[model samples]
Target: MTPVLDPDTSLWHVIALEVQRQRIAHDLSVTQLATRLRVDRSTVSRIEHGWRKLSPEQADGLDAMWDLQHLFRRLVRFAAATDDGNWFTGLMDFEKEASLHRMWEALLVPGLLQTPDYARAMISTKSADVEAGLETRLARQASVFDGERAPRVSVILNWAAIEQCVGGRDVMRGQLAHLLEMGERPNVNIRVMERDAGAHVGLDGSFRLLTISDREIAYSASPERGRLVLEASDVHDYAVRYDLISNLASPVGASRRLIEQALEA
Candidate 1:
């Protein structure tokens, strides 16, 4: 089943056609193609239908095997940068579709990891439509808890996020308790970066990395500068920062203990 390729808004469809055209050029059937590429037949189907976005590895592998002149990689990036306005809207869409969601939150609790009360308190300061924004933020958490097929979630939290009482003691108590519950999920890994993990790469600020199919995009911001960076270089830079923070963070067990300790205090 082939879908119409809207070339303007759908550079992703352009990639699908390029992959299909090249596969047929080589006279390989879907099953044959999957066998030859060592990927699942379903993967090929999804790519052809634009139902799944390609990772850089998948794109590069296809390029090397089929000689597609690197057009595949360029198109994948173009698709990621499709929307210029409402960065959060683009991010929410990405979060919904991403196979993996990861973040190094330096100052405040991440939305997906926040309790409704904590989120309400945090948003109250900036969001004019507090009720709608709170609902949207809470809804986003659904991505992390969708049964066994839920996206993998890894959150590295700065110790300050736990210590600060964003919505006073009762709200923080709920938030920490919620984190403890989320951390126990098989697909969720929560780590804490201690205050003494000073002079780390994450010292710059907080950022989120979403892995869609195989490619990853990152969002980072500060009061002075904020951006949704789509380039491989931008993603690569965050990955490096993430690694450094992870290395210094408390182990999962220790992180949970820290949360428990904070709850008691």
Candidate 2:
């Protein structure tokens, strides 16, 4: 039995399958389709396998070649623009699929790195069912951090987020210890923004920049709502903001020392 592709999880997979289907229906070989799209045959294969996304130029070429009057173009546009509003389904999909994740958190530890107790303390106050919420939060970490090919993650954590005790001394100490362990992983980098750094763009809120397939996405969250940003320009701005905030953060070694100091304090 063939498994079904979930469009909500990855619109790229849906688009890829559709392009392959269109090519087959038109009796075009992969090489021939590549020629039409002005991309390499490997590019075509990558697109079909959902390892790569169709660029706007490739989308336009497909529409022109098929004379389908912008069918592919519209799919690409919609895929880039699609978001799930408050549900954050789209944001979660991006987090799972992204090859690289860059995050800046001002008020608390990012969910991807939160400890179970810390997550419970945070989630319990805002929502019902602490056990269910804690389970879900831990599941999210497993998906993103425990994968065979875990994504490279770089985090800029505000020092205040560490000093502010959420779950009590034991919980805070455990969380900081966890952070140190995670930082030791080759794929993870943790940099701390000292509380004294005083006033920066990241102070506006917490956000993430995710690099997935051929594009970058930005996600910003408020109390109960989140937004997935796909506009190239907007995503670029987030990238730039991340760079600026990173400038204010301690180096990885220094950050580790800071965490250790906090742990001993």
Q: What is the clash count for each candidate, in the order shown?
A: 2, 0
Q: Model 1: per-residue lDDT, tens digit, 1-265? A: 6567775556687788778888898998989888877889999988888887777778878888877676576566556656343456567767787888889888888989888899999888987888998888878877556535788899999998889888899999999999999888888999999877778888788998989877899988665435667779978988888887888999999899998999999
**Judged by lDDT, which candidate is best?**
2
* Poorest stretch of ten by lDDT in candidate 2: 81-90
Candidate 2: residue pairs that collide: none
lDDT of 2 by residue, 1-265 (tens): 3345566677677788989899999999999998877778999988887778899899998888888877687567657755323436666656777899999999898999999999999998988899998887887888898878789999999998888888999999999999999999999999999978988999999999999877898988788777777669999999999999999999999999999999999
**Candidate 2, TM-score vs. the true structure?**
0.70
lDDT of 2: 0.86
